[model samples]
Target: MCKAKNMIIENIDELTSRGNKKGRRIVLELVEETLNQVNYYNIVKEVTKLTNDILKIKDLELDLNGFKNVYVIGGGKNSSSMTRALEEVLDGRIAGGVVVEKEGYTTQTKHLLIVHGGHPIPSSDSVKAAEEVLRVLNKVGKDDLLLVCVSGGWTALTSKPPRGISLEDHIAMHRLLMNSGMTVEQMNIVRNHLSQLGRGKVPMFAKGATTIGLIAVDEVEGKPWGPTVPDSSKFSDAVRVLVDFDLLDKVPESIRKYLETAPPSEESPTPLDYMNNCLKVHNLVIADNIRLCESAQKIASKMGINAFVLSTSLRGEAKHVGAVVASIANEIANFNRPFRRPCLLIFGGETTVTIVGRSGEGGRNQELALSAAQYISEGSRIVIASIATDGTDGPTDIAGAIVDGTLVPRARRLGINVTQEQNEHNSSFVFKQTGDAVYARNTGTNLMDLILVYVE
Candidate 1:
């Protein structure tokens, strides 16, 4: 059984009145339960068990004892926990390997060398860590077995710029793309082309080895750029994304040139190329946002609430989505149209924020929650909580924010203009002043973001 931590809403009682405090408490309890189900330690244990059980089937079994070398390599927010689980399962049979994780999330490993890297943006440490991963891959022989563990933050944690591209170029390109409001898929399409290890490039270094990838998927569609799996995206697709994002001219000259000039044949290995190499690789998605949503649904049912999963692939501008959700909740509260009173609506997926101008500290989840606050009708007993599963929503320490119908009125009383904060991309500051932010130190897991709405 998964052990859950307490809900992290600091001013929980203050966010509501005596009339709806019970509803707020129930919502917080549901959130806490859902988060526990996606905890890294619990995920690792569950995936490890599932992997072992699947391997027990005769058709899926591999003789690890026959391999000359058995190694593990990959990185992300959950990489450290995944490595620890692998170490426990494989024991002394594993050879030394490398794994990278976000700073401050590293776990103690006996054989795997843990590298601390940056997230949201790649840094010099990310470059060094990628190089070390490549070195480990080079040592694998034809008969070796390589276990690759990939999770949410792998893109930035394992970032390695291609030759002639400096780390600054990579960072600038990433910042531009992030601020440009491109979807994660679009950004990764361009990113896979510029990096050394993305787009199935990791298997290219394995030569004649057999690679098995255990992935913790953050994206809703189970599309995570496939760092170890065969990549279906083409260089042309990458170029198209750059143009679509209007980043063709804004990005660094090196990045633009690299994407424009690089021939498809010369680009990183595609799905077809992986078949020709003497390497065999398998990619398995052991967890995703769907699983998180399912767990939430079950917990809500247990609480006797009519829980409905609105969408697992929710995506759009954060603030707009927040209002959309509020509109739905308003409809339900006004007429009980969508189910009935005392219901829960759940959604899981990532949202984007287009940084129009100078921005302040805030993440998509925080902004979304704040924006949703406005659309909720006054005196309507509805509460919304939006949170990043990784615990760190953006660059800030807070996971996300929670708001009720009374939030706007409270902010008005405090002379805080919610709309002005939303316009300035300063939702975090507004949330801080209102004591509406949900705080969680890195949960060491990422399955995109989770939004929960409770209508009373």
Candidate 2:
């Protein structure tokens, strides 16, 4: 479904002066197409296809005779559409439940209850949705099933603060926490600690319910929601996050100055396994960065470029990783230790931006792309591109950047403001001036970002 492909570089004129529009538009279209290629629906379809063998569809496997029914429940940006697919597949078997997602989270049938919540920042409406989810879960029985559709935004969107710490404080802490560079798991530990409704607490509201977890792992690695299916996150780990962020004082005074009190983080009690009977929590990874790398590989092979997929779960600071990837490609070209010249190396992962500077477009992909571009300019014979699959990088609309050897000279000649751009943390601007920014409606699903370094 993603048809945006590469065009041969016939001449430099296409990206020079006024004629550069075509080059810019081509790059943008590529980004758009890739974004479209990664939508939740598309990702869900891919996930279902890959996991078809695992989904127990037939009631024949076990005794469904006395099982009252199955239902849907969850909250996130992608929860509704994904849950709808589940409802469509299960039909009458899915009796319906509460699903809280973005504002337009509507089910095709009137039987299901859809709740709208805020994103990035959870609003009062999200709190109401949380209450509604709890209310719905009260009706569950031993044989009932919980079909929870969870995506990246669940930690903030699906939860509400306890009796004391208000949502305002919760959000403030969350922003501080995310910008702090702690892993999502570490972040969630604190989050679950502050909230009354987290850990395995979601299904506890539903007595004897078996959970089917549909998840999108953005920051954490491997099994998403490990804390849910009876695995643990721990309360002390939450406090350590606060300490790590140097915000031990910022957490609400009632949050029990966890810094002054808890034992060593090594000896902390993680999220309790509250479920009486639990399912491994069937999680079919509907979407991830690996798909992007595979797609990039296909594109590269078609273009007669030797391709490689580095890693799907690559993590760390964007600039550091960018430099490392660029260095590797340089080594491959100069020494051919891994692969020879004219190779296309691709990587997929969620990279973090340590934004020490203020007033910047903080997308990690762009920052990394810029760093790679700088390396290419220094004689790597490389053309570089990196895009966030969600069509958004940090807070910018541009997916990422693309660059080549000529980028530096072009910027120097055209007064393209290189240092200023990087200083401002505007990867979008630097790539835009050189006709390299990718723009899409909504191509890639999840948080998969693509980094393509071309040597030829």
Candidate 3:
């Protein structure tokens, strides 16, 4: 049996040392195994190989002899890991390039310049990284090969607002999007129109070069999330999202006016670019949520626990999803309608938290965990856990949280009101008080979020 390449849970001993030991142990084992399966470096290394000067990644192969220079560039939470793997596989064949990673998520790379940038918000480093990538793209020739390593968080890591938009306005636009209840896809659509490096423009920059994208998908369908993939959204679609979310008036006036009156010439490259050979690109999904969910299910089955993947496309409010998961667990624990006890149920997708007024600290995963704790009954053998696979939940360092039936009572004993915390979106504090917060460094992969429920 192949062992897991990476184990990211830093506090597994602390987490399992107190909670219903056996159940936490099993759930964490699933976490470790599933995360190992999606390690960005491992996934890329497994699928990509260079033998006899020929590069093969998945079904695509390229003869390096035809290329004068090979470069790797892109940005995200997983950029450094992917770039490191490519550097290893390609060895000295790489001609040097630039890729940006969220600060503190970067790993060592030899030939590539790894620029640490800001995420969840853009900073000067983000602009600097964008400029560096553009510099590299400008150097590419028709015989050059460009490897675009993309993953979640790439938008913020390589943000470059348009000509008329200020960095302050760009930041404001993101702030509004975060609180607008819009999904990541919707936000990316709007961002695609405003940012210089977004909306499938990276490949366009290296138009005559052979561009191959190594993407770590956070969405269920694994659609385009950054520069390498063709953006299917239009300027009108971006305008529609802003209007529907009622963020038109709330966002910067420049952003509003740009999206509202942006001409067709400013639109992103469509599928026509590929059909006409104007953009030569190949995108490969190196890792995704479904594969992570399936790995959990497979691991559970091997452990003699019945497992079912509820959904890979879970969305909507974080707290509401928590309630739904708790309700389902209640059904199984009480009467086993949809599933039996001693079963492992899994869900994978990104959930949103629509911030209103002054919000407290927490991410969607933490809020979901806190909300699920409300429905858990005393002495019920249920362990519900949610985690953002990228390892950071919101602006906090916590990956997510785990809860059992006794969570509320335990929190009460410590003077932590679970309901109030959830209301204020202060889930990290609640989890901290209850000793249920999960911690891990960046797991070297971005596949949205994962929630697991183990009932007995």
Candidate 4:
């Protein structure tokens, strides 16, 4: 279990340097406590156990004596932490395995090959990791046991481009999808169509082995996707998403041709196909976004704060979501309209940033916080903050940013142009200059982004 003392945010003093001391304390405390509550290691430990050769996960049980070999495999932001727990529970039962994770996010392991790869985009290392994992999976036999640990960000961490498509073209396709304002689900649908180790293909390589899928989700449904579970999306769906986003021409010609060709044999396993296959699969959602938000709400309530979870499915562009959250807070503070004053509103989910020409550094959460700063009034006493649960926002090391009513005036005094920063997608630069950027190393877990609004 994660302790409050094990803070993922590295620059707490700097973040609390300018905001209302009490408000900053409350907001930062909520972030620290919530992250601890939903940590992957703790969640995995809660649902899994082993005793005298009978391995149990949640309500399912398996007799380890029947299997000749037990192999652990999969990848994601939190896979390393999840693997640590699995290694502890199973002890020395694990024969060998290959697990992939984002660069700089690996943990110490005894019986597994931990491969560090790229994130938000795949690199040559990502492709190599995918190959290594596939090679391990192919070695599994009918009597073998396969433990698949997957989390958000697995799509990029284990990359294997399909035949006729080069790695460069594959990476270019992902870049287009990221900046095209498509949701993560939409992006994965396109990705599931063009990879060898994705869309439930990993399990296919196991050669009839029984597979247990442990998933950590970023949305409310808790439904698992990617390599461990069957994808309901088809080639046509990928083509339509590209067309809907107007990215058909912008994506690489190889990807465009692959999606347009829509080969039936290359299609991912449908739900029915997966069910009838020889691969016996059991899937469980270990943790999710709603669980993370609820933990935050509960912690605030215990502190005598009126906290309410607005939605765990918050979506749309980052800038727009920020404005709406600020507007709601404004109404509550000035008019007591939707919610009364002295309340904490919580939101969770991933947001997209549609990059136009000349994009700047930053992620969606930082953009959200920066946009909210524009509408805050000095006397409103409203504090708005956003952070990626994984402790890395966008391509930067900052987790997210926090802003208050004083942010706009501070920017003016500093000679910073808020609108220009937003237009250029430069939230990281603005927040860093103002000492409000929340910095942290990778948290070894990801559910999505968490936004908190405190009105006093």
Candidate 5:
């Protein structure tokens, strides 16, 4: 490594690696800083703040008004944590509720029923438990208030099927949608519009129950995915998403047939009537991608690096996106444009990894890091990292990976090429051999990935 290259690596390592050395302390310090930024305290604080902004019907003494009982219902990776926050706010007012969350993450409360469910795909248990919830919803009357806590993973965790549609059909369609190239927002537009349980099924069934969503948003767009407030999407709009993505032809045969035959009618529910009460009553957005972005920036600044928040809502394909970030770093090195030396450019958002083949060990973030390696000049002074905030990126324990300009030769030495591997979605294998994978444990419930590039 040249003098400038060594300086850049030192600066990056100082921010990512932890130890007692000057660089180590700084790296540890930064990780801690970002970690602290996402502590239960801050998450609770933001959630509390949002909840407070809503109409405080509790102050009106719902019990006194004859709308006595308050029930909790939720689904997401953040569902359990969010339930805890809701319990703190509602105190003893909560009668009882059910919440489904990722395995090993549960929050028990006096009145909350926590259910463990699958993610990225719905399971039989999710449907069974969700059906049980529907039974509970059938019990709710006009006077009772139902507090629904919807977050990132709720789509798969909560469920009800449309007439004549098989559970297998729904599951297959969901899997295809996730693996498809459509964004969460675009996917949800079609999903919610199509499903009986979605498009405000919870709210409509529990009509006038004061539905509230404690959303931990994943999309870059300000509006949370799925039906939050009044879902503005029409059935045609939903179909158009499939058309635009060219994925309508790829969805499960049953789902495609259903979509083709389904009539456009007023009974085709969306989050309209319920949205009035839903948005007004909804409390927190447990957290957002921007929180993680700012946290990374603060950490980089502490490392004596000039930090820049590229964007909180960056989106697009993982490969193209990685290439763009790499281009920026190259420009910084050659032209010192946008940012000069000792710069840490940070971006946050969820990127997709399209696997057209059998597969290998890798997530979208890792693939992005590998693809970026080619754009970095050999011996150039730049290092980049892309990791999911949730700690686990994709199915692997590795959160993301870190790459320096030397990664190109490093991959070549391992009998791999960056461009070729990225095409195969074999980033995990490529980085594993070159030692660029960034694995972390306990990243918590936050979704989305963070990209950091240190350039000199």
Candidate 6:
């Protein structure tokens, strides 16, 4: 059972008062319930059926007696919780291992060495964690069974640059890719080429071990940077992404030269390579945004609101997507074209913010909610909210923001200009002043971002 914590909100009464208080409460409840459904404990119970001598994950089953040793290795935002569950299932049969987690998300574990690292940016600690992971991989024997936990934030949490690529250069390249507004897939394509453990490097090193990847699919499908799975990306794809972002010349010289000089044929290893190398690898997605969205839809139905799930794979610029969702809500309110009145629309996916100039204190979700506020007119019966599942949005303490039609007018009455703030990329500042920002301490899990729209 997952322990319950106080749902953090800066001014709870102030936010609930915007939309119908009862309606706002329903929304908050639905969000909280959906999060609980995908919590680590629930996910482990749902995906794996464990016994004293046999462990089954989906269609794959492992006999504990067949392996000489069992080790757990991988890293991400939810790795600590996942490891705890595995520890309970394995019951002390597992050998020593190492796993990296995002800072502040670590939990007490008995067997695994937990290391905290940075996110959205890789620190020296990330490199240290990666080294530890590599050492574990090297120590695995031919008869060993390796249980891998892959989840969101792995790209940044386990940063290990290839030889000749300095950490400084690697950090600069990562920052450039993030601000370039590239999709997660594109960013990871370029990242796979720069790191040693990325792009099937881990599986390649564990040439003789049987590996099973228990993945928590967050943003993208198939776990793009999965360390234990065979990477299907290519070096050409990395070059193309850099070119598309117009970052060919702007990125660090080391990165540019490495991709330029590296052989194009050195693509991610294929399944055939793994098979020929005498390795067995299985990957199972224990949870994802689709599950989260479906749970929200069910809760909305129980609350007597007509609910429609927009898309679990929503992508693109945050501000534009926000405006588009607001337009849809406007149409629903005016004509009831898509659905009737008293309806709830939900969307889930990761969005990008292309930082052209200096960026302000906000994340993609906050920016999206602030942008939606522009289209909402006074007395308009529409409310929109965007939140990150991990609780924090960007570097701000707030999870995200909730805005209604009256939000803009309220800001204007306070001598604040919403448009100017949006232009300055200062949505967090605006939300702070207006008491619209949603606050929650680190939720210990991440499945990208969620957007909720209510039209009545």
TM for candidate 5 is 0.83
Regions of candidate 3 where Cα sits further than 4 Å from its true position = 1-7
Show where candidate 5 strays beyond 4 Å: 1-32, 39-41, 46-67, 104-111, 263-272, 275-286, 302-304
TM-score of each: 0.93, 0.79, 0.97, 0.97, 0.83, 0.95
> What is the lDDT, from 0 to 100, of the residue 312 in candidate 3?
94
lDDT of 5 by residue, 1-456 (tens): 123331312233433442113322333335435755774334754545324323243222233245657777777665666667767776666677777776644555456777776666777776776776777778776677776666666767665557677778788877777767677788787677555557455666675665655566777785554434446777677668888877788877766766666776633454455544453344446567777778878767666688899888888888889999999989988998987876778788887766565666778888888888888887787777787766667767676777776778867877887777777778888867766666554444565767777776
List of clashing residue pairs for candidate 5: none
- Model 1 has a clash total of 0
Candidate 4 TM-score to native:
0.97
lDDT of 3 by residue, 1-456 (tens): 223344588877778877577788788778877887888889889999999998999999999999999988968997788899999999888897997989878878886888877789888888998899899999998889999998888888889988888999999888889877788988888888888888678877885899998888876555755688777789889988988998888899999898888788788887786667676789887788888899889988888889999999999999999999999999999998798778999999988999887688899999998899899897889998898888899889999988887789988999987788889999988888778899986688888999999998
lDDT for each of the candidates? 0.81, 0.62, 0.86, 0.86, 0.66, 0.81
Q: How many backbone clashes does candidate 3 have?
A: 0
Instruction: Give the CA lDDT, 0 to 100, for residue 89 in model 3.
Output: 96
Expressed as tens digits, the lDDT of each residue in 1-456 for candidate 1 is 223444444445554343357676777677777877777666666655325323321124676656888898868886787788777777677787998989866767778899977788999988888888989988987898888888877888878888778899999998988898888888888887887888688888887788888888886566644678777777788889988877789989988888878766757787678767756877777678998899999999987889999899999999899989999999999999867987999999999999987788899999999999999867999989998887788888888888887788878888999899898899988888877777775465678999999998
Model 2 Cα lDDT, one tens digit per residue, 78-114: 5665666665556456676887765433434345777
Candidates sorted on TM-score, descending: 4, 3, 6, 1, 5, 2
Where does the lowest 10-residue lDDT sum fall in candidate 2? 7-16
Which regions of candidate 6 fall more than 4 Å away from where they truly are?
A: 1-5, 8-14, 17-20, 221-225, 263-267
